[model samples]
Target: MSHDNSAENPKNIDRANNAVSWDNSIRLFLQQAGSSSPTPGGGSVAAIVAALGASMTSMVGNLSQGDKFAAIHERIAEIIGRMNRLTGEYEQLLHADISSFNAYLEALKLPKNTEEEKTLRRAALHEAALHAIEVPLRLMESCRDGLAEAASIAEECNKNVISDLGIGVILFEAAAQSALLTVEINLASFKDEERKRSFEQKVSALTQEIGELKIRALEVTRKRIAGDMA
Candidate 1:
């Protein structure tokens, strides 16, 4: 729940996660974010938003269980469990994003006055940049799994809550895309051509999978809503 953000200084990860409730924490985070301080920035927000989608998927799964959809009883349980796990992963990622960036920021502050200092700073920066790249990379993978689970649960959950599935699709799509953008930025900065290629491949794969799952969920959601009306 709490972590020191940077190796050198306490970063925003601790400051952001200290609130009493998720909703209150979001409110407090947003207020702090609106300031000049740049700790709980876009990466954290993306994970938080994706967490909302994952939590909603769990809600739908829990509510859709019982006699009404007994055929999917076991499946619902599994989906809810997956969503809970994804939710927890995203929670930790929210801090990881901030911590990674904080590490990069700390590297940037390294002394650059001497030739030796400059070389050391350069090496440290490349290391930190890789860390920065890695956080969003894992974030994309988490979003990838979260979106896939959302698609699977869409067809099984209650029609009354069908609309939340659509929202989940949108959030998952947004989360994946946002995380991809972050990775792309770091990929550009990172000096390892092979690692950049690997990251690029993941971005491509995650984008495709996230897209297909979102479309599949939307189609299923529409049919279910129409069937309910009929």
Candidate 2:
């Protein structure tokens, strides 16, 4: 009998530990999300939503090709590349959010019976809490950036797919808003006031940017669909 040790490799072990793939059915994911499990929670949902938005942006770009669009072909190509990159980033973020939450739970389990233990536990908790906040913060930032790229080509893309770009921007806004809520919830329990305020400022700016981008993108989409931009 041959014994296999490939799974024992450190890199493989790490991958197995941190893996959070969502390549399964949407219904399966939804069922798991709706279950009692705290994971695949709001943060993961936000990340996936952002991924879908990026995918939609890429789809619009792909459908907008032709001699009729020669002038802005380069711009559409650029938007597609950026949206592809954002889609990959959002997939990673989905895993990061779940892992960060799990890390916080592990930190909470750290022993705190003595003064030294309490100090160590507190440090662990603070680090975990910060990681949790950072994951969602990155999601918010990515959504804001993705929305900008998606909005940039909204009016120039194929008229048939204009609505998709609009829907993509809306998804970006929703994801950013959801990520913002996750960050704020974590901040509520966070101990560092100065850091909290800094994060809050970013959240506020992103909130405004996301909302404005959605409105502008959708307006372009509406105009094009209604033949006003023709």
The C-alpha stretches of model 1 lying farther than 4 A from their native spots are 1-24, 113-116, 228-230
Residues 1-230 of candidate 2 have per-residue lDDT tens digits of: 00112323443233224435679689878876676554466877898899889989999999988898998999988888998889889888888876775565566668889999999988987887898788888998999999999888876788898888888888998999888888877788889999999988988888888888888888889999889996
For candidate 1, the lDDT comes to 0.76
Candidate 2: give its CA RMSD in angstroms. Answer: 8.2
Which pairs clash in the backbone of model 2? none
Alpha carbon lDDT at 76, candidate 1: 86
**TM-scores for candidates 1 onward, in order:** 0.84, 0.89
Q: Evaluate model 2: give its TM-score.
A: 0.89
In model 2, where is the ten-residue run with the lowest total lDDT? 1-10
